[model samples]
Target: MLESLWAEMPDRFRTIDLESNALDTDDLTAFLTDPRGPGFRIRFGQLPADMDREMAWCCWRIAELGGRVPVGVLRSLIRWLAATVEDHPELSGSLMRAAPREWERSIAAAYARRNGSLPGRFWQENVGSTLRRCYEILWAAYDQRPWWRREVWDPTLDPRIPLRPHEPLGNHAVYFQQLEPLWLRIAIQWYFKVSLETGQLTWSTVAGPQRTALQVFADWIAGHDPVPPPWLREDPAGIRAFMLDFLSHVRGLITQSGPNKGKPLSPQRVNTLVTCLETFYAFMTDHRETAAQVLDEAGWLRLGPYHAMLWRHGEKGRRTRVVRERRQEVIDDTAFSQIMSNVHLLGEPIEGGGLGDEQIMRILMLVARTGRRISEIRMLDREPLLPLDRLCGSTGPADADGAFVAKLRYQQTKIEQAPDTVLVDAEIVAIIDEQRRWADQHLGPRWAQGVTPKYLFLGHNMNRNADKPFPPSRINQTLAVFARRLDVRDSAGRLVDFNRTHRFRHTKATSLLNAGVPLHVVQRYMGHVSPTMTMEYAETLAETHQREFLRYHKVTADGRDLPVDTRDLYDMLELDKRTDRILPNGWCLLPPRQACDKGNACLTCDKFATDASFLPELKTQQHHTLQLIDERRQAFAARTGQEMSPDNVWLAGRTQEHDALGRIIDTLEQTGHRTDSDGRAVRGAGVAARTDALAAEHDEERRP
Candidate 1:
């Protein structure tokens, strides 16, 4: 059998270069000598007829002389012998029987070497587990079974056998379990594959929480004895009840890990689990025609009812759910200044007390200036930077001193509709240039050879894989370490948390909006698909609103001075408390739940409050109202030959508003507030100078 298996090997292995050939005797010989070395291993040559038997006998001898062989040497020898006969089942069986005792001794010896003591009861129980895996690998190869196929779950199996508890069940192990319907199992696996291909889901996402939901659901069904599997074709009612019960149990159950262990899941987490389960049911129902062919109409109906229950439960649960509103955290001006002042000290020798890389500082700066997502920054391709001339036609920041600006292009993964290009500062472009030179020098010849992807932020570690993009976690880790070294703290006096790199994004967006950039412009800068998302990042600061109110209230559209103090104007309109209710012409102070009784007669209503800010709008309304009053008077005269008539009662109200608006406008003009050429309110020359002095005082007061 060994000879036949060897003979069946491809002819390419017979060559010296394994990359260009198949494995042969010479390759096997070289592999055994030094498996981790540079060159390809040599294959084995012709063997004696009793080779399998001889290997088995040698294994038995090693078991008897346990302490004679060092643990490491014994492990290597067993592995080498196992690989040699892995394709020969008869030989594998013989060696499996001989190696059990030897395997135990080797495992114990290896444990003692690491911990300086023998493993206790739990380790002892799992002693043969590694040896079992070796035998299983050989058996699996001989049987030609899929690599993921493994032993089915055994309820009585010792949970402690695997030393490491809480290990999730494998895909094959979960699918082969007898409790779940075969068709349902197949459908889920198929969905997982499709999702992975479309980038709609990740393997880790499906393997972790999705699998856990299914396992917990199955366990619940099992615990209820003799209840036909909840997924059974005849049990629509049972399935619906089981789903509701499962959700309730999940909601109330406390977590067993992380900082929040022993506390019930948050609304967000509960919602996530609900979504996961709902997705599974949705997939089944979406392909109902196919599923019915396999499980029949009864089984298909079971899925529909359960899906409906999940939808209704989610809707009702959300009504009463108290989802905590989380404020977007950002690095304030003080923290940003401090970070920039000390950032250059990172990545120095340990003697200088440096504990981070300079590369992270560059990344943070890029995020601050560009407001790009961390992932988008991380996955930037080899050549991301462009010259200002290349982007002459592109929308970007204005040029300064005729100097070249930098534009970066990168894919936006989160919001797919967002644009992929952004304007960056020349300083950031210099940083990228420096990184490119460094990568070329340090990343071997791959940069020059053009054989590998030239990631701008390549990993520097030599022990692990190289020439790959740096992990986002490493960037965050560097920030955390640097933050600790500086002892950074927030306003609350707690140590500043640097875990969220997204704070830089929020900080950038807020800064741009507060600097007077229009909302639509800021939206484009931040790569937001909608203005709403941009607004979330541009949450207005109290200081910003204060400054705007002070600036606007001191002038009128026609360049006249205002008679009222801005604070009194704000008070009259209740503007500070209800900013949204203030209109250009007047303020509406009515309660939100109440209806307006005066309708369009705002100027005539006592609830209305107007100042110089309303002069232009009031003038416009007065002109229109006066024109309508004249038309109504003419109609009344034409019909009744009277200047006033009951038919003109509506006109009487309009006349009152027209007169009231005219009086308000005259008062604003007398106080020196008037419109300019552009129709925007401006303060008179004397008032403008006084307003400037007051603004300077306000600025001085706000300074640190």
Candidate 2:
């Protein structure tokens, strides 16, 4: 079976055993025992370059001493060798020479020399089993075979690619291994590889959720009786049914890991999975010829409709489900200020409330201040800091003789565009300067001797020779440790985990918006391509608006009940309308018209309403009205030579207006309404004013 399968594979996949010489017991013993021996590197190097050399050496020692390797050990070696052969086609012949048959013969000879028959037909059964397993492993590794020559039918179920141990949510590794009809797996791998190399995705994204999506599809297939491969074409309705079932399964199933373990998968996760699978089907449709042998012409015709069904499923799921009900968690103002104060003290002794290593603290501060994505900050190049004087034509607000403001320039990976540059305050510049000095003192010499990029945040793993940017995981872990040490908590008193670095981004964006920064400015600050994306971060702070309403508009003068209908309030605010009218005293409730007939008489107009907070302004206006009335009376006396003239007739109307203004002011003052020195209504004062008005009305009613 193994030989036939090998023969059936394309010429590119066939391994040739060119070595004629058989290894002696003495040579095998030295090869296994000594790390310095030629065979040690030769055999282990066939695996991943980063494979554990010590573990491989230990496995070899066990095989040498016991005369028969464990099944797990053999399987592991075969998998590694197959992977090596797949990556380096030239090494296929070398790997073939070191196959399990040679190992079995050598082990049997060693046992026979010891006057012992090989234990329990282990050589006949286990060795043959291992060889067959090796064949299966090799077939899967060769999934990148040319589209035209790929396998049309699915191979026999290989034990090497077992069913998932648990419900696979985003397990790409398992899915890729289990995905049948060799061509389909190859095409999917091709799509992802192209996507990564073409800069359509980062390796982290591809390795993570993208792979998980494929795993979910594979799991969906496995849930069926006698699982069908993804390439097996069904009608559009059949495909729709399958997709609906997959979605149902995902929704019904509980998560196996993370904070939400044992809970039903969030709608967002399900929708994301659906979107990923939809993309996968679209990729398959684009590369339809790759699966030509498996999918007939009719099947190919169904791709468009099937892809449509997948899209609809995703869209419908999103529409019907309350995906992400909770507002985005952000660092509140008080918490943010506290964090900033403590940031610089991070690396100090724990007794002094320092978490130590001020580098991470500096990173957090940078994110909080700049609104930069964590990726942009983490992947900062060697000399990313630039003086503001250099960015602007000359010395500007950002520049002060020697203490110039600086801007950070780095590649924005989220959306491919020109390098993003954001201004940093003097404090942030100082932190950057400090970090630069630290890197120069610690990482410079070692980096100069190696080939790693000059990343600002260099990895600490010198043993592994990793001189790249520090992984986001490390930064998050560091934050989590510090958060626990600080005993941080939200307003609800729940422990605040700083593991999510994104909250800093939200905190920054929300702070900017709350500070009355223009939407476009916030958008630019956040490096968002669209204002809509920035709005998502900005809009999550509904609590801020609620607090503002309670602070300013919740009460009215005269202690009158000013009940606010939320829907009416929303209409009055009219946040979505660009033409919404906001007046000095209050918003104009009237529709747009030619002119104001009331002549800015907002206090007395039925269409207008004033908060008791405007009492001082109303009093000043009344004084101005009285002066106007007296001036008109003097003019009439001079012209007609009489105390009561036609001009004086307008004075009666002016007196009535003055009396009306007095009544309005008296009502507020009588109702106990008070204003601050600036004339803004005192918070909660409206409640008192309303209480007094209600009492006065009650007294008047009783007298009547």
Which candidate tops TM-score?
2
What are the Cα lDDT values of the candidates? 0.54, 0.54
TM-score, one value per model: 0.56, 0.58
Task: Write candidate 2's Cα lDDT for 3-58 as tens digits.
Answer: 34434543422223211124333324322223343432233444433222322333
Task: At residue 96, give the lDDT of candidate 1.
Answer: 41
Clashes of 1: 30
lDDT agreement of model 2 with the native: 0.54
List candidate 1 stretches off by more than 4 Å: 1-106, 109-186, 198-237, 256-261, 289-302, 305-309, 313-316, 319-328, 387-404, 445-450, 460-467, 540-704
Candidate 2 vs. truth: CA RMSD?
13.5
lDDT of 1 by residue, 25-65 (tens): 33232122243555332222222233433333232222221
